[model samples]
Target chain A: MSELYQQAIKDLAAKGSERLAVPDASSTLDNPLCGDKVTLDVTTADGRIVALGHVTKGCLLCKAAATVAAEQAPGLPVAQAAALADQVRAMLKGGDAPALAGLEPFLAVRPHKSRHDCVLLPFKALAKALASF
Target chain B: MTQSIRSIIPVLARAGFHYLDNAAMAQTPGLVVEAVASHDRTARANIRRGVHEMARRADAAYDAARQSVAAFLSAQADEVVFTGGCTLALNLAAAALAEGLGPGDRVVVSAAEHHSNLLPWLMLAKRKGFAVAVLPVGPDGRLDLADLSMIDGRCKVVAVTHASNVTGAVSDIPRLAEAAHGAGAVLVVDGAQMVPHGPVDPRALGADLYAFAGHKAYGPTGVGVLWGRKEILADLPPVTWGGGMVAALDDDGIEFLEAPHRFEAGTPPVAQAVGLAAALDWMGRLDWAEIRAEEMELTARLLAGLAEIPGVRVVGPTDLAARVPVVSFTVAGCHPHDLSHVLAERGVAVRGGAHCARRLMTALGLDEGCVRASLAPYNDRSDIDALLAGLAEAIQVLG
Candidate 1:
């Protein structure tokens, strides 16, 4: 509703950068009542992400999380993907996470504690891809 | 004038029994305090405890209330077994009939049943290894009974809802009952929605058993009536036991009481019963058909308005000609919760999400869920207009 929130949503929607990360498997998180769902695609090729993407529906936070997580941890290993999910989770929670370039899109999301998982969508998808492998 | 949101609304933001969002939690009227109030003042003693003046009075009130509920359903007082609520009543029906069945004993259930009706039967089949046949509903959310013909011979019990809580589509219960009976299965109707939508008479419906919740019908919470045939009640097994459910016990085993008591195991919700009785008594005094017709008019108006809104998909029957005021819908490209949130901000109460019929929604692939708007006789035309305005605003916000 605010200008920053609107801007953040627009920036995420632009989704200028696309990446095929190493970890191919991902986890899906569904908020049943809100009907917000995100599947994180995690793929591990030789124990590293070779490709990553997400299919999601919900609020701006959820969409932004998927886009940010994918850009941050695609080429990383299982450990790196998990760690990045943690960072995304931290950023969503208003906790401190290192300033990875693409992750800056999520800075607007920090104050809303309730949206932590929504902002963590992409990485969760990747985790699932990894878990399955 | 619209009924504006006096405060923030409820949101169904998660799953589980308490998954109702802040909006839903906010919208739900609290009856616990009210339930307690009646308990201390009237219907206080163990109802029908007997032999004392106070007990005698309580017994008369309670038993007479039972008779009233029976009459409400066009049944005999002895045929009604008051349970904790709809859930327990359904469990009573399913578990009782499910007992003593061998492998291949079939149970037929519609996909539109609420979790209260579906789960008990599912558990019964899983535990007993009976054949469970699930029938589907057409897009209108009513049973596609042409598909039901396939369930013949295998169905030991046919369980379905009188009206879907999610979609508000009224099922043809009498027809379904006939089909089940022809197949040698008893028909169990979950009337939670129907009872609230309008008055209902289960005996006339020819259903072997009917389960309805008091709260939704303007009665107190935690009290419900399950009306079954006198013969059917005698045949059912008791799932719970305590002071009243039993007649006598020996070293050999425990002997249960007859009809209602056999199922009602403990200290009943006395205040809740009294309140439910009061609600029923109040309802009986009203000209009900007029109330229902007024509600139908309101629903028709709401449905027409919703139809005019872009991206709105009303999920129940197309024939607004044959349904309750309860309605369900999904907004294309917007999650139901988002739509619900926008409306709540405007103070229009609505139910969002799967509505506890998880498997049915899954089968329909409406897993994200839809928004439900249930109207009572008290709701009026202004409410419909307000709901339409609120829905339009919600769509704009999402877009």
Candidate 2:
């Protein structure tokens, strides 16, 4: 349990956020398998993300991933923000953790194949939101 | 007795692997496995085709399987139709019944039905211009029959589950049958969950048609049974068509066979049917009264143990009066999938999701669904204890 549910993950997940009042781009995604949902609202400026807000109603992994996305999404280029989701997906498939610092905690989730979607759902919403912008 | 039952299933010999996902698929028994293998090895031929020795053997085995399924439902052999699975059987019923229905005709279904039972009617109703009414589920997860007016004069069909796969709440089929009959509607029951517990007399229960999966009954996959009254089945048109189901093919048109033959299009799952018969034969010899008593005791123990846990809420009826041994629950501040994963790490198997019953989940106010622990005859007290202990740890792990 400690291996997967590390204190860092718990803390990050506890730092939940709400959706933005008015956003440039927003997207909502659902993991139909378990009914986990994540909605992302982004504020973009000068062709880059300046702020990220999220409303995630999912498992601990999903919530923690969404928090990590929210924290690191600021100042990220639109192309790299979408690629970050791909990196996390590849990481879940036994690839190295993305260069992002906060994503390493999700390394423990690498062994759980089914929960991969849970960890990636928020990142997917972020990608979709970026596309919408 | 439990030990002996467990010994017969090869997988139960594995240490520390507690399986509680019997609702999805029961662990196959050695007898059923061997029967399938034996049929494939000895009687491997297309049934109802040539007069060759192998064909005769295969035909005998297939007919015997039909007879066994018929006996289980207390119906005649000619009334049974083998299908790929319970979903296909329900789809066939819907497609065949849709022919007689049109606009202004109402087909009443329950809110507690699995997607397999509900989707077929909804899809067919859209095409046939029939209205589909839902019977509401009570707070306890049982169908609320207080308003039987839903089955009014315009009603043509009443399709529902005999027992809910998630909640394990058994329906009052007799009362439902009475209501359906009073409205001059046919009652089609999804018996996939109930048949696994024990043999059910669909006719006695006031059903015109019944469907159940073979795999859930400890039989081979790719086989299911759909039994309807002889007259009703004769009237129902075939949903599928191919070589074996037809009689003669002229240049102008093709002549189809009778109910069971017309419905069994293409080459059927002969070996799987043989295996289902063997499984049902083994189940027939068992004293269900004793087994059910033990199952109820386990259900009682499971409910009590769940009650002792903090923030754990049972989704279905808390009592064991009219339910099977299936239990579903959710934990506060812990998602069911995460908890199920933690339990899987502890070698406890369970299912977590809407369980293909989205309507029921919405009715129960479960946004993330719940974890279910379904029991079979081979499951004993140790399995229940393992699940309870694993859940305690899962709460801590995901909390």
Candidate 3:
């Protein structure tokens, strides 16, 4: 197994907290090409994310990305979470990696262009959910 | 046999690429590529129009292509009509046949049909108010012909695939033709998959109209053949109108050319047609028995290897006699897209998706689709070995 699959599997096995209570904002994103789906729920307090939960039915890469997002979302400002989404997109597109410690694992996926969408699926849903807040 | 055939494709040796996606688009032989390039360089001009020298040469080449295609299908020269591609050919047939029908007319298509065969009829049914009935496929991935009650005298056409792209199962065309003929309905066959794997004589297959794409048969893209009986061709009206198809036209009325000529609109794909002829010629020189024998061996290896994997489940028939070498499977706990990506990383190319037969995917309960490895004459046991190795690596990585 390559370092990429190993790192991605580490995030895929993460167990996060429960769904945000009556979630303040939620969004569902689907990749029509492969039928991968990700639904993200966000709860914000004082313009900061209080909690986040994700339900993903897709590839391991997608689920892993969602797990990473859920782990890093709590206590972060909504704007920062949205910015992290942008950073993730840039990282997948072969740009320089962001300084966030949690995002270091995604550096392994840089060389695979076909999997960029898989890594971005959860990010896009989270961005939409954060935007609603 | 495999080494000899592989020598004709330069990329196989140069790039060391294991091409397992022949069911989608075949790798054009070096000779066929040269045929297309040489035609473009030397004899490129508008055919059937100008009276100049180059025009005449172009006309001769185009005519030769038509004759070659007709001969390949065991059809007369006048029975063949060239179209943009297989989809266009099927659409043309559907449009022309639907013109003679009314609201109460019916058209029956199998559930296993590619979208190209199913969509045209559904569009025609919507426009002409004809009812479209679907013939269900059994669990074995073969069409259930047990219930032919839907194909009654009211049925105007019965369109089906000669072989399924997803299942690799060959349909019993002769029996279908007989049933359609008994019900006074014309049989239209989508021969896109069958023609590439073996010889197909449309008349002997009892099809009134047969459509196939050139690229699927190691020919160039943008060219396809639609062969119909002379009488049937005459009865159907031309769907497209343009400069080349008409004999004489005025504000009063228009007189069109006969049969095949009337169907070709605007400028035809002359070079592509030539390439298709060259491909057919190349295929004709090969011994089909040898090709089939090699493919069967490779297929056996693939099925056996996949069967050994605990989580892998093969779709379609498990027996060699029932299908071709097109094998589709789903791996537990692994998405097909991810698996395909891993295989591509390993320098093996295969198709992963619904394969343009979403209905078949649904029928097989593969909601997330499956990975497909399709074999061709150029493929040998080593290619299958590479595939199995790649698959094993994918499972280990994605696990």
Per-residue alpha-carbon lDDT of candidate 3 for residues B1-399, written as tens digits (9 for 90 to 100): 889999998778856478999988989899999999999988899999789988888999999999999888888989999999899999999999999877989999998899999999988888889999988998867899999999899988999999889878888899999989999999999999888887679999999999999999999999999999999999989999986899888898999999899999889999999999999988878899989998888998999999999899888877897577788899998889878878887878998877878788878887777899999999987789888999999998887
TM-score of chain B of each: 0.89, 0.99, 0.98
Docking class of 1: acceptable
Instruction: Flag clash pairs in model 2.
Output: none
Q: How close is every model to the real structure, measured as TM-score? A: 0.82, 0.97, 0.90
The second chain of candidate 1 has a TM-score of: 0.89
Model 1 per-residue lDDT tens digits across residues A4-58: 2455564674463333354234466777544567765554568776566666766
Where does the lowest 10-residue lDDT sum fall in candidate 2 chain B?
Answer: B1-10
- Against the unseen true structure, what C-alpha lDDT does each candidate score? 0.71, 0.92, 0.87
Q: What is the lDDT of residue B250 in candidate 1?
A: 91
Ranking by DockQ: 2, 3, 1
Model 3 lDDT per residue over A1-133, tens place: 5656775465564454445668999999987666678888998899998878878877777777888788878788888888877888898788876655566677788877767888888888988887865
lDDT, candidate 1, equals: 0.71
